[model samples]
Target: MSERVVPEDSRQRRRPTKQGAVLSEGLIVETALRLIAQHGADALSVRRLGAALGADPTALYRYFRNTDALLLAVADEMIGRAQEGWTPTGDWRTDLRAMGLRIHACYQSNPRAAALAAHRTTGRPHEKRAVERILGILRSAGFPDALAVRIYHAFVDQALAFAAQDAAALALPAAAQEKEAEVWNAVYGKLSADTHPHIAATFPLLAADMRESGYPFALELMLGAVAALRPERRNS
Candidate 1:
């Protein structure tokens, strides 16, 4: 028979870390997020996490089975924070816009963690609640089950894809970020009109629009499509 593992809470009660600080799963996740924010996602290792927490690296295993498990917890925390104060307005479109923006803002604010976990499915409490909320919004808006699920997939994935893309940009080193930021002026902005007439014609507009994250614009388009597919519209 395999050895039975002890529960995390029981373990936590038994011993504090070497620095005399108590280690809870919440504290560990918080420290990991801080480490990622300061040093980038690549800096997240059990050893580094332990050092930051003043704990034995082995002690971390008592709470999380592995780094992946801790990552899921951290990912779930992102969802939790995003959903913390959110309430659906009576209007489904407005609620969705609010939710999509809230999640994007949360991810943008913690780009290092977002870059690492944006595509993750945590199967944790916060993720479960978010899934429920989105489905609830669609269903309550009169979408049939199949259609609602389909739209949910597109909406959530689009938000995450945009978040990850934006986060990757945010996560770049300072020098790389500056080079990318200068591309509009240094490369596209200087293209000969004869060679790239269309781009030249729109260069002023493109320059202003391209500087921001595309999530909000993409989100509006998505919401418009979803509105078109609403059950009432289809039935009419």
Candidate 2:
């Protein structure tokens, strides 16, 4: 009987070397982040990332214990990007608004990364700094320490959640996204005049505002509500 021989490349696929591993972790993470951003978190896998990196599947374990850990890292990296060059000007409202918008913009830039990081807390340095800065702004605005923390939590959580939802909606395939818009237009455009007089009357303004702005309007509304609840204003 003739002995069977495995292909050289097939054998090489089973093992990876540490040489030139400097770029391996970063490359894997970047590629995974891109894939996740484009395809959603469920689309990522160590094996797939390795294949994308042209390394052994086991090669990724050197940097990430598993996919979850790598995801956390990606989340941290995205937050870090959001916080790059951030500096507070000491005006609590302006500072907080800037911070909120910056973080929101970061998610907007990469919806996939935002979706993955949305509900997952890494407690990474950047995340900690963001929390501290937000809490500081609230406290500076005369919120009680405890209340400031609570408000900060509410603000960040809501902002991130909304960002994630927006990202997911935006990430939909073009056809599906257009279909959603068409459905909205159809439903709103065809509201019966008599049965929905109030809604019908306001439909033009609503549609105009919807076309002009979506999340920014909501973010502004949220900030206005939070500002109205400021302790200094309440005391005055």
Candidate 3:
């Protein structure tokens, strides 16, 4: 029977709204992400998400027990986006470097979401799949199991850590963000050569260079160190 096919407790049921919209878990998660993007991380909640989706606040509970569950879902969705376009070449170092950058870029695209993901682990299928792919890259590079695992752990942690830091900075209110720039210009730009010779020397470059991310620089340093540890390179 149709009833047997679709149980009474089935949470997959969609509810129509006055705005000619229907609510589902996917829609709820998508709207939550949009709200975070538009209004910053503080924008999310059962009520706010419901309003955005044009559904009752209780309707969201059917899909996700609470906000934490919903945030994990959002994070997993972000990981999926990060991993979607990645295709590994045969070169392990190249692939790993690219992978790091890709994840960074993915998190940057949705800063508030990244901030939330910073402290939580989804332990979900998408993240697991990404892990497998990275492990394959390291193992194929002739790294022993133990070393490969260590490198993978460090590499991922570094990328995510930097992404979160960058997202937190970006999540600052517009006035706050501008204040950082103003401080760098007003303070760092005016250091005296007699009192702060080193800073004065670098002041010209600081205006432009400091504005750019240090993630790529740090990532390359880590990757180069890992590459040198490859068995053939070590023995040679």
Candidate 4:
């Protein structure tokens, strides 16, 4: 019989050797992000993530101590992705608007991941960078340091709060969404025309607002308010 030999790399691949471990911290974080995007934060667990990665569950602990660490890493990754390719335009309103829209779009793109990351303060590098960028925008707009800080706080809180709410809404099953819509429609649709004339008159508009207008509109409104608050430009 002819001698048979297996290629070393092939053997390593088949036997799950740590010699060339395919899984790393970055890969783990990326996988976790995907899981969060696909199955919501509630569905993500070490076992589930390991299964998805085709690696031993304990293998993940080599990179992340626990699910919370993994979640923080995911948050960092989300914020990092949001800031990618962003540049300071020097125009305060334009820059702030761009930053807000980028963050909003990022959350809207991965509602599940956003749901996990939006509210938690990881204080990661990417988040710090985002904060600096926003503060810079306010400063460029001629707001004092205190006012700029306050505006940044409000902007971040509102963005994340709305992102969390939107993610929760999006995570609902279609049937549940329909049911909730129906309940709201029925309850609000039944308001007496005599007693709640305004409600009855604008029911359609209200419902449309509930469905059509979302975080982006709210974000713009917030930015507009901030701009209005900016000290008027002095032409020296």
Candidate 5:
């Protein structure tokens, strides 16, 4: 049998969980996400993260200077996850739509993290790769460089903005979530037809349609407008 090699230098500085499991950046991020999901986004703190990991709070500082760094990591991980297995079909419209939906799903998957990091920058490797990939898609569609960049900005910003809004709702407390739903049914759906004829006319369909995601519908509107702008792609 061969002698076992030990990571003495690396292992020396590693932290451990209460159960003796070794701590890692990935585990910390995963635990942090769970804590955010369990508590509210506003409740994320170094102390809470340490507790979740069963390690001293200071231990996290070894990997992250502070909660903001951790948040950045979480945000990058979310984006990385979103980009996984994402192979383009070369059809700009179809591919862009798929990518938008993926981005939306990623944000909603980790609502609290999404809300916190939406306005923040994640200059990590995965984020950079994602940006390059998106720009390539727009370029491949035959959009002029400047115009492609503009559309890229609009497409990304629109997706994230809507995702953030949708995620904020998902992160609301159970009672709050229920309350919002009740408003759709008991409030908006019940408006007086005379006082609000337009809303009243659509009120019947409101509850059902309202329960579904607005991202896809809004995405198509954006794509259609973009197609119109592209003379070559207008028919496409």
Candidate 6:
């Protein structure tokens, strides 16, 4: 069989698929996200995407180098969604909190994709813009250059790490998730003070804590630490 070649013009404008649907990078990513959300990340193969978009599977190569490239694009789109319509309030801590929460929520909403792609570094516009905004927030808040970079690095990593962790839990099967959620009450709730004094005493707190995400509390702790490092705060 002769190897098929993509026309250069096809790259310059939106290409119509065999089923007559227009194809663009944005369309591909959006379609991929919806399919993944509905059917899980394993449903994101080029063949499936092509079928969904009514395009040749090879046509996706025009926009992405390979499956990983497409996955990165999807990941970047998640970041872009988290950033949509958000403006920094000029208060560094508040802005960071909002950014962190937005990112976590975006990932949780697409647990399968987030579980698969959260660790990927997509050097795309959305990721780059997020990095730029975070650095700018820290730098403008009186953090020294090196300090700002360090804090920005930690902040981004922390957000991604929590997103991945929470998304992993959410990605589990419904039955498995329900069983896991019950462990705190089923196991820990039975511990007696005579056998495990500390745990028994804190079981109420532990049960509440275990049922929810710890990201918000962790975010606040990080922001409080950063607050103490701000030059103005330190000098004052």
lDDT per residue (tens digit) for residues 1-236 in model 1: 11236684555735677778689989898999999899876556778998898887777777777778888999999999999889888688998998899889899989999998999999999999999999998888889999999999999999889988998899899999999989998999999999999999999999899889989989999998988888765432
RMSD of each: 2.9, 7.4, 4.6, 8.1, 6.4, 2.8
Candidate 3: pairs in clash: none
- After superposition, candidate 3 runs with Cα above 4 Å error: 1-9, 233-236
Worst 10-residue lDDT window for candidate 3 reads 1-10
Error of 1 at 154 (Å): 0.3
Tally clashes: model 4. Answer: 0
| Residue lDDT tens for model 4, 62-107 | 6555678678888888888888899988887778777877787778
lDDT of 3 by residue, 1-236 (tens): 01112233867646586567777767877888899888766666777876777777767766776677788888988888888888998888789988999889989999888998756678988888988999999888889999999999999999999999998888889999999878878998888999999989988887888787789999999988997888985332
lDDT of 6 by residue, 1-236 (tens): 11344565665437577768778889999999988887887677888998899888877777776777788899999999999989989888889999999999999999988888889999999999999999898887888999999999889899999999999999898999999989988998999999999999999999988889999999999998988888866332
lDDT of each: 0.87, 0.73, 0.83, 0.76, 0.81, 0.87
* Distance from true location, Cα of 25 in model 4, Å: 1.9
- Candidate 4: Cα lDDT at 96: 78
Model 5, span 125-233: residue lDDT tens: 8789888988898888888899888998999899889889999999888899999888987888778989989899988687888887888999999999888777575
lDDT over C-alpha atoms for residue 159 of model 3? 92
Model 2 alpha-carbon miss at residue 16, Å: 10
TM-score of each: 0.92, 0.83, 0.90, 0.83, 0.87, 0.92
Q: After superposition, how far is residue 184 of candidate 2 from its true place, in Å?
A: 2.8
Query: What stretches of model 6 exceed 4 Å from their correct place?
Result: 1-15, 18-20, 233-236
